[model samples]
Target chain A: MSKVPADLRYTKSHEWVRSLADGTVEIGITDHAQHALGDLVFVEVPEAGRSVKADEPCAVVESVKAASDVYAPLAGEITAGNPQLAAEPEVVNGDPYGAGWLMRLRPAPGALAAAALLSAAQYQQLLDSEGD
Target chain B: MARQTPLFRLHQELGARMVDFGGWAMPVQYSSQIGEHHAVRRAAGVFDVSHMGVLDLRGARVREFLRQLLANDVARLKTPGKALYSCMLNERGGVLDDLITYYLGDSWYRLVVNAGTRDKDLAWIRERARAFAVEVSERSDLAMLAVQGPEARAKAARLLPPAEGSTALTLEKFVGRELGRWFVARTGYTGEDGFEIMMPAADAVPAWRSLNSLGVASCGLGARDTLRLEAGMNLYGNDMDESTHPFESGLGWTVVLVPPERDFVGRAALEPLAREGSPRKLVGLLLEERGVLRAHQRVLARDAAGKDAGEGEITSGSYSPTLERSIALARVPAATAGRVQVEVRGKLLEASVVKPPFVRDGQSQI
Candidate 1:
């Protein structure tokens, strides 16, 4: 089973969000998503200043098996992308929740409250329901 | 539920990622697909090919039956233990399945066919064997393992019985010999020196474990596919099917058109195709970009005037671990030039057309 960090909020699509003290939020695919994708070879992160809606695809992650879209958990304006991924995409498979963070976003006024992001416990339960 | 091979439990024990392949619960990879692929090319790797169908044909006129049933001339197998690769075709000259037939003795021959096409191939062979009084029997009691690479033969020979090990070491390419309860063949699909061993199903796990102990890496179907594709070997369903013929699938060499006297199953349909020349031909594509190439991607060919010449489809494509580049096998117009554009995820990327076997014997061919 993959680790579900208790500090982060998650989406059913597998994206995780970490709200910063400055009102900005950091986002990345969860460990479960990375494990499913397997050995990331390429990652297309969203650019800064781009607006994304909740549940909309904002980035792409590709592995040897297939390519998958990374959706935004809540509507926001992109602040910055992880520039380090262009050279080394395998970081997503290694430290998915930390240095492998996809982007930083400035959330819309009511987006975080309106978005139905699941808690770490809720995400863990969801993962358990998807039995091997 | 998918069928499980004799080594299924062993695969699970080894932490292989299992997948449903051709109705069989087979390992797609253990740790990494690229790692397994490199192991096979650089050293040695063992594959559980037990899901492949094995059939034994026995009759006074077995040779005659195969001569009519297979596109390749089985009569060429005058020497015992000789194997021939051929395609079984439908009446319309379309390929039904590609297989290997080994002439074991005067009246006995063995065939290895694709796992997915097992039922259909058996039914077709049985239906045709009736006239020749040949008995087609499926050998479900056996399992197959392909130990492939530069050092594959020497490493695997150490595990066989003494006398059998010596015989296996001396076996020539494309030849099989029965020793004790095992049948060892000096043949492989990875474009490497290796042995494909067939033994009792009960011995699969033990033999796999023994080979693993000898520093042979356990490979799965994911590596098997990439290795074969790099070797320019065709996957039955991907490279050709009922709608495609050998002429267009880069398998014209497998078809025996000589002596004109012998008539094979699809010879009637293939005759005109041979004379008139096929409009489409299979070619290799080398991607010049960063992205990976996959099957079913559209390929656009252009003429000298920059106008559309023809369109093609990638039959099999992947990021070749050996070359560290994306490569593919595609069916395109015979007149297609070196340069073509492949539409990948809405972006047209330029690619170069080259002869296949992109990497063979751990060396790049293109």
Candidate 2:
């Protein structure tokens, strides 16, 4: 089981959204996703200033075995993307919620309400049900 | 469905990811591929290769029968406990399967073949064995484990029966002997020092537990794939099959067109291929760009006509932990090498062409 923080909002694709008072929403993949694709070797985060819709593929997560796409949790205009991921992709594998945050975005107001996200418990329940 | 090996339950208990390899349910990986790969390189790792087929042939004319059956001359295995790598082929020279035949005595020999093509290999060999009256039997009741690494021999020696320890260590590469209940062979696919032990099914669990007690880390098929790829070893389905001959798949040396008196399957077809020349040859490629190479990706090699040889495909590839770069074994034109582009997705990733068996003796030779 992976750590799902109470303060973070969750997407079914296993991404966490951290909203700040300045209206910039930080995005990163959840811990569960990294554990599935172990030992990250390379990561390709979206370029800054690229506008993407909800569920858009904004980055690529590459492991030693295979490559996968990182989907955006909500509609937003990319404000900044992590540059450190290029050299030290293992940071994403280690601390996905903190230094591993993929990108920050300026969302259209009401584009992503708090109600659209799931709580940690709700996400865990969803995972449990999916496993069933 | 095919039969499951003795380690099937153990794999499930360890949360190993299982896939149907041919027909057998085998673990592809347990935790991470890179970690397991590194373990086998630096220290030691164990693999459950019981799915592989073991055929025992015994008769007075066994050697005579093998001379006519296999492509490689078996006269090399004159001494007891010596093993020879050879290819079983059709009369025209198309490969049936590549295998290792270990000689225990003049009257007995054991052949180990790939898991996927076991049935076909057995049927083909047995069909011909009837003429020589050599008995062929598939030993499904036995399970095999490969413990490989730099420290593999020492670890295994400490775990084997005390009386047989010295003999087990004394066994040369490509040789095997019966040490009580276990058949210990000093051979490996990882390009490292190790032993592949075959034991009766009832004894497999105990042997595995004993080895685990000796601290041999259990690895899955994922590690095996990367290890073999780095070692420049060939996988049956990916590297070659019935459709692909040995010449184009980095196995041209294994075929013997000499000794005119000897004739085997697919010789006629391969003779013309050798005479006219094959268009492609298998080579190792190190990805210069930042990406992973995979099977079926197009290789853009400049051809003799000076045009891009429209398509060459990667047979096997993985991120080599020892070399810290992505490497692949690809089938390209005989004239390929130097600068070539591998098509990963839509992008043409540049790679350096070099000879294979990438890492030998824990050192990157390429």
TM-score of each: 0.96, 0.94
Q: Write the per-residue lDDT of candidate 2 for residues B1-366, one digit (tens) a residue.
A: 656899999988878878899799998888877888888899888999999999999899898888777777787788888888877776645567889998888878889999988999888889889988899999987899999998888888886777798889998888899998889999988888999999888877777777778877888887888899989999888888777888898888877778877676677778888898888888999999888888888899965455666568898987887887789999898888586899886788999888998998788898
Model 1 C-alpha lDDT per residue in residues A9-119, reported as the tens digit of each score: 999999999999999999999998998877677788989999999888888898777789999889989999999997788899999999999999999999999999999
Best by TM-score: 1
In angstroms and one decimal each, the interface RMSD of every candidate reads 1.6, 1.6
lDDT of 1 by residue, B1-366 (tens): 999999999999999999999999999989888788889999999999999999999999999999899999998998899999999999999999999999998799999999999999999999999999999999999999999999899999998878879889989999999988899999998988899999999989999999999999999988898899999999999999989999999999999988798889899999998999999999899999877778999999865566677999999998788887789999988788768999988889999888988988889998
Candidate 2 lDDT at B241 equals 74
For model 1 the local lDDT of residue B296 reads 96
**Model 2 spans with C-alpha error above 4 angstroms:** A114-117, B91-93, B303-309
Candidate achieving the largest DockQ? 2
True contacts kept of each: 0.06, 0.50
- Residue-pair clashes per prediction, in order, are 0, 11
Cα shift from native, residue A40, model 1 (Å): 2.5
Clash list (residue pairs), candidate 1: none
